[model samples]
Target: MSARLEAINITCRDHAASGARWAEILGLEPEGDITSANDFITYRIPGTEVYFAFQPPDNGEVGDTFVPRIHLDAVASGNTREQELENLLTRGMKLVVDARTADGAGWFTVEDVDGTQICVGRSDEERAAAKAAREGSS
Candidate 1:
């Protein structure tokens, strides 16, 4: 049987700092403190069951270290896109770029504290479709 994913673990130079950054960026709540006994801090994103664990680098050469190749995508209400984007910036995310699609939809890319790129926002059409789906279901 196939299983569901629960959490994603990432390595950084400092787990606590990374965890704190992620907590603020994603509106998550960290459950444990990163310590010598447990070198990880698990942060759970609210309204979801997923968790993200941040830890220190594994054994390797000075220059050879864990570089995450993952990217995260999130959807926001069309009207709240600007507010959410501002919140992400306030939480230490660096904006890479922002552009509008041919259909006049907008999207942006930002880098997290660990340099992991995350894409937030959606095209205007996509936002409208999502809203329509939600309203139809309700």
Candidate 2:
């Protein structure tokens, strides 16, 4: 079958703005140049990598700013989503949404520096608790 995301792509009206914000917020360096108009500024989370493309925006308005709506989520891997959440929030990220499953597992939604929606999840503490519960049940 066809697989999961190789890289999630986001297009921003101002690549420089988004790239800079993400860099500061995520505490991750951009994988490459953040200057080229046609280039994608990248960020790698533990498991997934997100790339944001800087391009001219269509004439839409986000409360008077013509920014794009290319929202992307930087999901945490390796069971450290709680820590990841703390790290991101400490860097000025704002919680926008919180998602959960029928099994009570999922991610929290946060808005990035550019006002793009980002979904973050539980950290090591929650993961460990879940894992232990699973083991005890088994």
Best by TM-score: 1
Counted clashes in each candidate structure:
1, 6
Q: Model 1 off-target regions past 4 Å?
A: 34-38, 60-66, 69-138
TM-scores of the models, in the order given: 0.42, 0.40
| Tens-place lDDT digits, model 2, residues 16-58 | 6776787687675566665664545665544444444444455
**What's the lDDT for candidate 2?**
0.60
Report the C-alpha lDDT of model 1 over 1-138, residue by residue, as the tens digit: 111235566767666787888889889886765454256788887878767877666663225555544455554443455566787788898999886466536667778887876666653455777688779999
**Alpha carbon lDDT of residue 29, candidate 1?**
80
Pairs with steric clashes in candidate 2: 81-122, 81-123, 82-122, 82-123, 97-109, 108-120
